[model samples]
Target chain A: MRSVVIAFIAGTLFGLGLTISRMIDPAKVLGFLDVAGEWDASLALVMVAALVVMSLAYRLAAGRSAPFFAEKFQVPTRRDITSRLVGGAALFGIGWGLVGLCPGPAISGLGLGLPQLAQFVLAMLAGMAIHRFWFLRKGSH
Target chain B: MHNFTPYSALIGGALIGLAAALMLLLSGRIAGVSGIVGSLLRPAWGDWGWRLAFVAGLVVAPLLVQWATDKPVSINIDSNLAVLVSAGLLVGFGTSLGSGCTSGHGVCGISRLSPRSILATVVFMAAGAATVYVMRHVVG
Candidate 1:
């Protein structure tokens, strides 16, 4: 219950931030990505600001034994550099560069009632299903 | 220097960081959108509630902002149907295979100084830039 509320609040804040920063705008994202033509450095500032605050927050979290609602910190523990990580990230980046919408903006944009966003999201889910069926079903990372 | 919005970008970024921090401190979780949404595809027992709540919050945020500010949320998508569909498929598959996306690896993982995340971030950024270069400069 408390965890759910916390999750909701966090998610809301994230969405609001994305909107306010104009990160929700695919054109804006593409502008930042367009290094060769009319580059917009605003998104770089977004990354810097987010990193500054998150780094400090992580430092604080480092001192805590457990979170308020959960008994343990749930975080990724993998360390090895695998082909899967590299290849997957590359593919994801290609997709992102192709259409300036990643999961966060794509999911948030659902509220706008846009048919295009719906189409993108449905296809994304299908892609996820494909991954689950092919890669996950094999039981190998 | 096109459409540069420094103030809003900074403020908005801080807000995102704050949300991520609160998520970790309050619930012991990473506010990685991909991980949150991806796990939902499998829907394990006793774990789908908060995930749904989080997604619902994301889905409702733009509406809430519009209602509060009396201004429609700003957004733009230039890609046609084919591009959108293919891109969506790639994103879904890649994020699942990679185990994180921007929020996960770019922000949270990097902040934690995780080597794996740093590498993933670098790889994705490079790939994204290269793709953009090809499409905008060469192909388009």
Candidate 2:
């Protein structure tokens, strides 16, 4: 119960961060991507700022033995490269370029209640379902 | 370059970082949206509350922010429904295949200095860059 609450709070904070940063604006994002034309560095700055904070937090947290909430950290074990990985990256790239909205920004855009967001979210969910049932399952066998 | 005020971005990033840290401290879980959302679909024992709350918070927090700030948020989509759907499917498929989304791996995982996350971030970012290049340059 508590953990769910914690997760919800975290996600809310994240969404707020995206909104405040103006990351939800696809034009701003596309501007950042327009290196050859305008070379908007705002998004880069945002990324760097995020990295700096994350670095400090990790340094402090690592000194401790375990996380404050659960028993221990939940890290994945797989390290090898695979097709799903490459394919996923390619697909993600296409999506980001086409719409200028990734998962985080897309969710944030939902605040506007735009029909496009609904379409994106639904398709995203369906894609996840397909991968979970078909690809991951088949790959494990 | 235009005159840049990084105050908002910095403050926002810090809040997100703090939120991620607090979530870890309080709940021993990484602030990964994909994992959280996935867990909601086929919830395990006693996992419904937090997932619902987390998603609920996502929806409500912005409303609160807007109410307080009165900043109008406008959403514009250049593509059609088909494009949006295909794009969403691709990202969803990628998230499952890669084992996480940008937030899960890119933000939280990278914060932990995980090697897998570093690699995943690289691949995903590169993929995004290339896709953007192709879409805007070649296809368009």
Among these predictions, the greatest lDDT belongs to 1
Q: Write candidate 1's Cα lDDT for A1-141 as tens digits.
A: 998999899989998888889898888888988899889988788888888889998888789999878999897889989988998999999999998888998998898988889999999898888998897678865
Q: Score the docking of each candidate (DockQ).
A: 0.85, 0.60
The TM-scores of all predictions, comma-separated, are 0.97, 0.89
Candidate 1: regions farther than 4 A off: none
* TM-score of model 1 (CA atoms): 0.97
In terms of DockQ, which candidate is strongest?
Answer: 1
DockQ of 1: 0.85
Error of 2 at B47 (Å): 2.2
Give the whole-model CA lDDT for all candidates, comma-separated.
0.89, 0.71
Model 2 per-residue lDDT at B94: 76
lDDT of 2 by residue, A37-132 (tens): 555666666666776776776777667777776778654556676766666666766666677777777766676778888789888878878877
